[model samples]
Target: MQTSTMRKARYLLLAFSSVILTTGLGGCSVSSILKKGQAEQKISVVPQVLEVNGENVLFEVKAQIPKELIQKKPVYSIDLVYNYGPKMVEPIGKMRFSTGEFIYENDKPTITRQYSFKYTPEKSRGKLLATPHVAKVNKAGKRGKTTEIASGVITTSKLVVKSNTVSLAPDDYRKGVSEPQTLTFFFDEGQAKLRDYLGTNMGVLKELIESNYKTTLVEITAGHSPEDADSKEFRLPLRRAQALEKYYKHELDVKSYTNSSKSVKFRVMPVVRNWDRFLKQVQLSALSPDQINEILTIVNSNVSFKEKERQLAKLDSYEYLQLYVYPTLRYADVRITYEIPQKKDSEIYLLSKKIVENRIDSDKLTEEELRYSATLTPLLSEKLKIYQAAAENTMKWQAFNNLGVTYIQLAQQALKPEIREKLLKEAIINLTYASHRNPTAQLFYNLGSAHHIQGNYLEALRSYDYAIKLGGRVEMLQQVFADKAALEIEIGQLDDAVTSLAYAAPGYQTLMNKALLYTLKGNYQDSKTFYEEALALKPNDALAHYCLAVIAARTNQENDLALHLRKATQLEKNLTAKAIDDPEFRAYVKTPVFREAVK
Candidate 1:
């Protein structure tokens, strides 16, 4: 009976709860209140895709807050996610804003932001998309970490980037090699005027100017020997330079270079005592190394320049220095800088004929044209005739040297032994005259080449050494070393030949020669290493490929040997015969692939 009473009480309580549900608390529940509050607060995102300039892509987006949300005083942050390429997606830079920072008008807030990647102007190659997200700040004055709402893709653009092409040509194809020549004019004691030898050197200088496409600058610097009085040292050099400048302007009547663009510049260098030359003389003298060191220590002290000079003057060996060094420092040096542009074969022929015929128009003929025509004409006879005329007219050292070069070329190309001998003799005579006119490194180098061809090995080596000493003009130093090494090899001085190439320029040609030398010494591994280095420097070098093919054959690398041999013969047809007879390829000569490759 007690259990039944408890059951009856529970049913009455349930009936009361049903009445409360049927009735209304303003006809709304707890969930309905939350939903209504959310509906009242409104925030949205506006998206845009824009092209900035012609090449840049920009993603512009804005956050909009209605008056209702602003009145609610809620803070929010704007965030963006973007894609740079088809497969490249990353978060755009972090961006946040509060209602207070936005421009407010009539209780509404507006805020904007932008993001950019890079520009590509060639092909449409990439995609860019930006999606914005918004988060509300809580009452705690901290941003809510969650992204409550997000906008659609704000920007999408394709990328276009152009490709660049590069080109490489061998050094052998390079034309218009520029060489620097020095002109020295000596002066008597207290004399700043030109000397008799100046006429000869000046003629050479004028010829050089007339031979270039553009005479850039003529630097005339004068300096005095240390023997002059301290007060006179600076004054004498300045006076000498001023006199030379005056001579160039008033006496020489060279208005074109002076008036053109101030191409002729004059400067007075400080009085040069040739102290380095003095040191060399001291070393060569009977003085001991300790004595030389002591002298240098005094000369190189931190004392004043005058005090150092006084110390040098007080040295016991000053008399020997006076005799060897002082005389050479009293001079003016002329440095001519000019450009020589490359010319076509037809242009060279036309210019050569014009030069030989004496019909070259000074106004129309460029210095490079005159130079190329006189030097690079195809026919040796034409070059000889042009240079012969140039020699007769200018009577310059360069003219004779060029004439000799033409003869040397003619001799090299001549088929008949007697004609070759005669041409070689003529070259020798002309070059000897050139040496007398100007003892330049280039002159001696040419003479060395001529003597080497004539089988005078010792004379050739001596000339080569002298040329190397004087070859401070340009990039010709390495070529001289290369030629000297070739001469050394001819005389069977293999070790000296290798030593001679120590200073050879790091180029494909020199590296290839080094590879050959190593191969001759039974160093196939080292030979292969150097050959690979040469090929890396110049991929299109046929000789490097041929040499590498030879090395591969010797090492029993059949595949590499065949591949390189085929490539070498393909690049240079004449290499086919060379590959056939090369003792290095003797083993490969019988291989079917090697036979087919050479064929």
Candidate 2:
């Protein structure tokens, strides 16, 4: 009985141990399942460094999740953000994968997406981060680990050239000025003789000659009444013109005005069958519009001049025309063009300088002279001072416009941001004032440039459009289009840029922009060609050389890359740091030669 009891105890102990072991094994299995569910993911970003194209920062992201990472009821997604500054983050975009849509059983779950965000200067030094999450349907997701996918934006596209067009006021400082004087003499119908009463009209001509004003030309236009049959001979008008010429010569000789008339050129224009003068006089008379139109219709008809005259004679208003207009037409219209002396350029320039320096009265130089003086100096500071003085003294729109443009030019040359800003502000103020006075194409164009430099892109574009709307000289319009195209390139309007450039004149800026366009389009050969052409125009152009270096780096021409980079750095030392940070030379950055060349 004791042996049987001991056997039952042994069997109960063995069964209890087996149950505990089975429970431990089941717990291990659950822990293994949980570990498998939380597998690690791989995320990759193309252009590991972000790039700014036009006005936007652009990049791409790809995520790979292991199979079984997402359970039947769970969804997978990634949230992206651009961290530029402390407490500053820009939301990029999100990518989500639902359980049913992605089959983890067949293959690893993979997703690739493109992302972009508007770029700002503050966001240039930034990183792009992506965080993954797993969630149940219709519930908050558990956040996975966040990872940085891209860094530091490339802002090479923002280096577009700013070509501002400035407007300068014209000066009335001509070396020689021409003045015209008119003298009229009337004659009877069919007669070509100088009347005694006509001599009175020569007094003004005599005074003009006596004043020592050089008589450059003496033009006599003689007309005869068409009603007289002798007028149709065409000799009558010539004879009338000769009579005036003879009288003019007699006056020149008798009055001893021969010195001023020595070089005078006499031209006799006769009106015989032509009805233009008669019609013009008739139109100015108290005739009705209907009568004028009737006369115009006959005169403009495809008929003989005599036939038109016959038709005119049939009109009811013919009698009035013969009395009022015909007599006026049958007279010598003598026009004497004379030259008036003007100060030499050197003298005018000296007077302008004296006026600016307060050495002479401001009235010594005209308002135009004050404004034009700014253009004679090569120094921008001098120009600025002159324009300011002109604006203050003249209070003219042209002076203000020139002053504003000068301010803009000075701002462009300023090295300090604060100074540039101050100058640009002054420029805007003066330009705005000028616009209120009288808006011109040049003023609007300079305004656009100021706005462009200030980063007011929309306002700049509007100003540029306004400049285009206000038409100007062909050269000025071409410059405007070229500058507008440069702005378009900075904003990612490549197609629009191409169209804008079509109307641009061929110049250094236009060629450089074309090269930049070709570079963006991946036409490296054409881009290189254009860069070469641009360099030819401006041999020491640092930007053009740097662009060539970029092309060389892209094309894997190591020697050319080093050559251009060296040239660029020699011309502009700032390019050395730029090249070191530029991704265009990323592949060569690790190489010893690149380091040596950059150094």
Candidate 3:
């Protein structure tokens, strides 16, 4: 059942990779990669030559044949081994042998030769050496029997010596060369010896065990192999490797997005070698009802990035998401204190975000494997040194945004208004396009804050309004209420200010103003109580202190008026201006203490 599901996953993965490169402005490119085509191999090496000049005879020669040969530089070498038969030799220069052009400019035959000379008969022999050509007898047999002479094979003129074709295989490669992935999983070939696999992949298993305790990270894993246990053994290895990858994902229960809510999807790359096995495993020959159900369940479970984006995009509240992909390595046997760096984790977060946001994005990645990108390119740090360079380079757009946002937030929190304003402006410019192009509530809210700080009230209001429209959660509503109310009060729209501030908490400065409203209505007792309450919460409420003094004087409360008058004077030193100008404080306008304080 698992095998059948894995086969389907591989088909889907291949299909995604083959999706033609299409641009938002342009249609699919001329070279639309067909999902149907297989992963064609490149020229692994070129023909080489080797020589062990010992005897007059050449014996064996070996060539580095291509597992899957494409366009390669046609080149061959003549390996001449002394005292050996003629053999072919593969060429070697700087370790790698091929130039990747099949047609060889220099067509030459590899030749090896051998020569033997007898001094007496079979027992008595003279040693002979081999040269570029056929070995020739320098001396005749000394005994009555003429000296028996042996020769070697010679090429046209390309120096064909005796063939002792012994291939010099490079240092032993990893056990599984085709799949150079760091994450590897082993099985009992076809058995479910869970304990054995757990013991074998000690590190993965240990990590998996620890993951059981961490609920934040939702892990998903699928199982696959090059071959099927129930079927032939040829493709089981690939299946096994995929199965392990899936297992870790499943055991870890990785959270699929920033919200840490949904389950991570499990997928497989079964019989990754060919599509025939891929198809058969997904759609097996007629099976029993239960068997078919199990197969379907597994097959239907795998999810793709584009598919995930589509699914998650359906949520109206979910404006943005991030995907994080990482390849972590662990030594099962060794104990090491290695920590995944903050920068690395940040990268994962950004990558994950891109994956989640890929729905709106036109360009989609095929597989999780990153390309080596050998084409001439500048180092990443160098490329990011300037804005122009960063703009010119598009590959690391996601990375740049990640770092940019972190810096932008830091700038806003800076003590220097100039620095804060500069960063906030840049942040708004960058994030405006980011959220506008893709649309995220968080980015919009930040833009609103920046604009508001820079005194672009209307623009700030617009941004805040849109951000709220995009995201209508309670927390988001709070920001809008606070900003709008403060702005209204600043512009002296006291009526609107009172209405807006109704939603604000009493602990705010608006409470002092609210107390004055009661005093304006000629409610002396209420004003006195409210001012006292405001002072109790914030003893340095200067406006409240001054208001209390005026209310006391109007009520003819000698002790209260004197105390509050002195208190307000101490708190505001500038209270004289308010007492003389404010109509509500007119009664205290000529108090001797107030006059002396002002003088």
Candidate 4:
């Protein structure tokens, strides 16, 4: 039974093999059907229809056999290449070709076939080339995530992979896959002062980098320039980019993109695309959130903004940076920061950081400057920085106080002793003017300090009392009290001086100064107490030891005093002359130890 079945199967296999050979031979069988100069050839397809439109059928073409193709059976197949658009196109699979029905001679054999093709409304023809058909994608998804959605197209144009692919096409239409990013910078007009606006943006970019600096291939660059009516400098775009680069390097420490990463191989091509015009058009105001949103909403509502696109067509250089307007102070404080495009929260984050890290107008700037110089500064610098703030037009109150403070400093720096009084008088000119111009407690306090620096004791006293009455804070009140105590000592109010120094010591420069005052008044006990306190604050201070040595010599403790004297002499070689010239040291002058210490 087994032999019978095996013999029967062999016969069946031979029949099947013959059938396969015949079908294969029939498919490749080709002959020229040229008659009466009418040239034609029969073409074969895999019988896979892709679409159907009556007689106009398209195919999931298996192969295309060219006219009298040499080694003709079928050598290889080509994958179909096409594009509905840049993102929309890819390779489908290998396809076959077909020849439209043609007439044959009366005696010739007859055969017929059909095909159906699939298509979307997107043009199969690219801006470059076109292919006839491709393998069925079956499902169109993201590139590499699915079968290549092919079309009948070929292109020579190329794009950096990381960058958004831009179509170089018919109408330069927009797809909007990449949104326009925005960053804000507030400029103190004509001052080059930087403010939080730009600083804040930088922080956001940094945050993004922290997530994956090397992997993200992110870089920040800036440019800056100014365009005033008087200057011919017009390279704004270049300047702006340079400014951004400088800030990133100095402030944020972001490195430029490197060629090692294909995603960021290209440098940020910041250029001078009309800096003069950009600055000229910019309103010198710090942008606010609402205003920025308003401007952004308006700008983004446009045809281009709605579509986040990098149009190859923009190379025509018709585009401009879009900036929004926000509230500006009388004299705007300048700031600049970075922004990651399309992310609103990043903008706010950088803005907050900018507020903490920067300030406009610096004490280092000239008094006549229109803006403050900014810096990578510490806390004390922040408090003292705005002292020289300038007026845009004029806020009577701030300007009034500013002028008052300026005059006072000028008087103090006036070196010639004879003209010191003149300086004070000039200071009063501004102080009195400020008193008339919306006077505040701060104004009164400044007036008091000016009077004191000018050596007008009674006038200084009156000003301090008035400043207290005008509602100053505890620290300010303490300062006034301390100054009053110093005046008491000058006039020989020793008991009163002791009391004042006891309360004011903490706020004053050093307890030693007051201790010396006590020593001059013959109060060794009080002097010693103060000297102890001073030493506590400055344990390693050489001057403190010198002061203590002078005290020991005063109260007849020669043996105890000699040790201190020797120590003071060793600490400061000039201790002897300092003691001899000091009135408080007179009692110690008779001591041989004091004389020896001095030598």
Candidate 5:
């Protein structure tokens, strides 16, 4: 009975298969296999990757999985990989699909996934390539080999950085009255013509003559040593003075007159005596006190200038006097006076802005204007642009130096390490160029800042020393010393820091920096004094109050400490967190007062 039933079932199954094949072959439709041109696939991304905000690169992938495949419930996975050059030290960023928790809806029948990944460049400016790999999942919940669905090239443009250029103080902006610059020309024993040694002095005089001034007063004073006081020799000194005056009027093209005139004044005074000078030399020498007194008595007596000189020469110390004292006495003193026209504060401010803006024509703006403009602008970016423009326009050392300084400022502001390194290199190039063009104190000072930023402490110190030696504008000098002091403090060179800070101006920031340096050196008393001084300059300074609080806490001044800490926290709320971890308040950390203040 069982065998008969099995044969019947087999016959029935065969009949069923035969009927289905016949129907399918006869053009009946089936939903299991995907038809040609039925499946749709597309990959697209807006913006690729250029101009990505922050670190994220967002892309949308849209596709329509064929309805036939949807019936099979096919699963797909998308993977993204970032190509950063040939080698990547680490992955750029992570990527995430919109959602994969829910099943693909047959009604919807679309494979839509919003893909996102964070991107970071290896350099300041570099290419970033992102490729998306897509694969289908088998029934076993395992992913098959992936095929690159889409790819994009993300580019990063160069990033640069800077601080604002600060304007000069009101007093510094105004030009003060010019004091007379004197140039002395020494003659070689009766020789009145120009000497090889006098060329430098003469050139200086020429420069003064050519400078723009309201008016120039040329005062020539003729002086001769006691030896040349006689009628024949006395006239030679006046003749020599006249010769120099002639050189000034003719060779240097200086406007002047032979005698006292509206612009120039020529004074021919009596020949000067060296008797008093001779007495001083004798006193300083190894000569006995008695001998020196005797020489002075003879020199100071009421005698003719020539007679006094003869008596002084008769002394044992006369040889030293002949070489040192006499040569200095026989010289023509040329005093040139000119008035530096005072500029209004507004004018300087405008000029400085113009220079930084590079709005003024190159032909119209002077080098001084460009240099001063670099110092006066309040915005660092503007300052950098202006210095670059000025350097190109003027091709001067001052412009180059200012440009280097601007680069250093930019480096300070840069967010990326690679970008900062590039900016510092640019600074070094400009600074070296500046030194070659004209090694000004300001140039060395800027170089110092660059070196310091790069961790070249020794080079920074050398540059700072050179800057101080060169002696730039007083304001720049102050800033340079202040910066030097800051470096010294960083290196634990406390005494040097003190010396360096001594040269800085007595400003609020400078005082605060000094206080910090002293505090680092464990001189709480000195630090307290400087912090108080800083507060006097800037009453509402949060940093000043914060530092004072630290000092007060260290010194066991509990009441003052609480007062200042509260004030600091009130002024700047961020200080509360910093104070919580600061070791300076270690003594007070366990106290309720400290906890309350920080909390």
Candidate 6:
């Protein structure tokens, strides 16, 4: 009985030990499953580095979760954030997966997502991170450790040079002005003779020739009355023209004027049987429209000239024509064109200087004269002073507009920020005032430039749009479009920028921006072509060489990359550090060629 009881106790102890061992094994199996799920999770980012498009930073991420993890937890979530500068973070996007929503029959769950966020200067250097969360159904989830998927934002698109279109008001300043004087002499019917009293009419012509001014041309047109019977022979008009020419030579002593250095050119046109002058005089008479049309119809008919005149004389308006028009047609018409002397450029400049200095009355020079004198000198300071005087004295829109444009030009040459800012501010004020007064396309274009330089991008865009809407000269609009395209590229409107650039004039900036657009689109071939064109226009452009180097590195042309990088660094020393930090060159950062070129 004692032996049987000891054997039963041993059996009972063995059964309890087996139960404890089996429970511990199950616990170990559960821990192993969790560890395997954690180890199998995979995340990948395309491009590996974020890039800016238009006005936003964009990127793509693909997450692969193990089936084991999905099976253990009914819900999965991934949170994306862009972290930059001193712990600042921007939540870009989020992705969620649930067991009921997604099927995982025979494959691991994979999710790919694209993310974007508004790009600011602060976010230029930043990293994109992703955090995974696993949760049980109807329970709070546990968050996984955050990992960085992408580093740094590539902002090559922002390198586009800003094009400012400035406009200056035109000036009506001429070196010499032309003054014309007309003299008329009347003769009796059928008489191609000069009247004695008509000699007085030649006084003004002689006075002009005798004066210091030049007589450039003298034209005499002599015609005979259509009623004359000898009009057909056409000798009467010739005789009349000769009579006037003779009187001009003898009575007016025109030969002396022709012999002088300030000589005059004389042309005599004779009108015979031709009814042009008679018809013109008739049209100017007190005749009715019907009478005028009747006369024109008769004159334009396919009949002999005399027959047409006979038909015109048979009309009821014939009496009015003979009394009022025939006398005027039977005379000589003289027109003298002379040049009025003008002040020299130096004299105008001195007068403008005196006006600006308050040494002389502003009224001494006309408003246009003052504006024109500003252009006589190549100095911007002198122009500024002249324009200021014109603006203050006249308060004209042209003066104000020109002054604003000058301010913008000065701002471009200013090296100090404060001075540039002040000049730009003044430009804006003056442009705004001018725009309100005139609202011209040129004024709006100038306003856009002022705003662009001051870093007021939205305002600049608004002004540019206004300038385009209010159409200007073709050249001005082309420049406006180019400038608008540059702004569009900076704001992330790639397609719109392309369209804008189509109408833009081709230049270094325009071509360079086109190259940049192609680079953003991954068309390296087209990008390289445009970059080459732009470099041809401005070979010393360091930024252009650096851009070419970036393309060479991306295409794996190590030799070209080294060559371009060397040139870029030599031209702009600061670009060496830039290339080293650039993500486009990340793949070649440690290579000897890259290191040597940058060095």
Best by lDDT: 6
| TM-scores, each model vs. reference | 0.42, 0.55, 0.29, 0.32, 0.39, 0.53
Please give the lDDT score for candidate 3: 0.37
Residue-by-residue lDDT tens digits, candidate 2, 297-366: 9888999877877898999778756745666666788898766455556776787778778888876665
lDDT of 1 by residue, 1-599 (tens): 99999899999998877776545323333333223333433433332223322233445555554433332223334445444355555555544334355776456566655555444322122333322233333433332233333322211111111010101111121246655445766577667776645112555544554443355555677766556452255577777766666665553344343333344444445444436544543454333356678778976778865666678788866653464344445667776555545667676658657767878743244433444455454666776886676566556666677788778878878999899989988887777667546645567777777777775668778876765544333345556667677666544466876866675555765676677677766798997898899788888878778777867876788998988989899999987976675545656688798998888
* Per-residue alpha-carbon lDDT of candidate 5 for residues 368-390, written as tens digits (9 for 90 to 100): 45455556658888777767876
Model 5: worst 10 consecutive residues (lDDT sum): 155-164
Put down candidate 3 lDDT per residue, 1-599, tens digits, no spaces. 99999999999986766662252112222122111001221111111112112111133322232222211211222122223224422221111223442332224111222222211112111112211111113422111111112222211111111111111111211222222112233234354323232214333344323422222232222232222332244444344444454545554445222222233333343432232322242232212235435534433456642343344345332221111000000111111111111223344334433443443231222111111111112343222232222222332322233324534545646899788777667655654543443223344555566665565556766665554444333443444545545544333344654554554444534455456545544677875776788788888866676667667766876566667767777787776554555433445557765555445
lDDT of 6 by residue, 1-599 (tens): 99999999999998887776444423223344334445676778876787887677777777766664454344566788889977799987776665553445349777777778888777877888887765566766567778888888888888887668687876645556775656666677788766644222343344334443456677888887777454655677778778777666563354354334335567888876777766666554434568789989998899997788789889987875664566666777778776544677788889999998899998777666788899989999999999999888766667888999999899889999899999999989888766655544577878888988787778888887766644455567678888888888887788878877876777998899999889878899999999999999999999889999988987999999999999999999999988887888989999999999988
Model 1 lDDT-worst window of ten: 160-169
TM-score-based ranking: 2, 6, 1, 5, 4, 3
lDDT of 4 by residue, 1-599 (tens): 99999999999999988886544433232222112101222223432212222112244332223333222233212334444576765443433332332223353322333333333223324221123221222422112111222223211000000100111001111122232223333333333334444122343333333422233223333333222311223343334444554554443334434212344321343322223223222222122234334434433444542232233123222121221111111011112222222223343333323433444322222221211211122332331233223222222334345545544445456688667677567656556445434333345556666665655556655665554333334444445546556655543344655554443426223376576676665677887787778767766655656656656755667765666666667777776655564434556677787777666
In model 1, which regions exceed 4 Å deviation?
1-182, 185-383, 389-395, 409-424, 452-456
Q: Please name the candidate that would achieve the greatest TM-score relative to the true structure.
A: 2
Worst 10 residues of 3 by lDDT: 323-332
On a 0 to 1 TM-score scale, where does candidate 3 land against the true structure?
0.29
- The C-alpha stretches of model 2 lying farther than 4 A from their native spots are 1-39, 46-49, 67-77, 85-88, 94-113, 132-146, 168-396, 399-403, 406-410, 413-426, 429-433
Deviation of model 1 at 510, angstroms: 1.6
Candidate 4 deviant stretches above 4 angstroms: 1-397, 407-425, 435-441, 494-522, 540-550, 559-576, 583-592
Clashing pairs in 2: none
Candidate 2, run of 10 with poorest lDDT: 25-34
User: Could you tell which candidate, 5 or 6, scores higher by lDDT?
Assistant: 6
Ranked by lDDT, top first = 6, 2, 5, 1, 4, 3
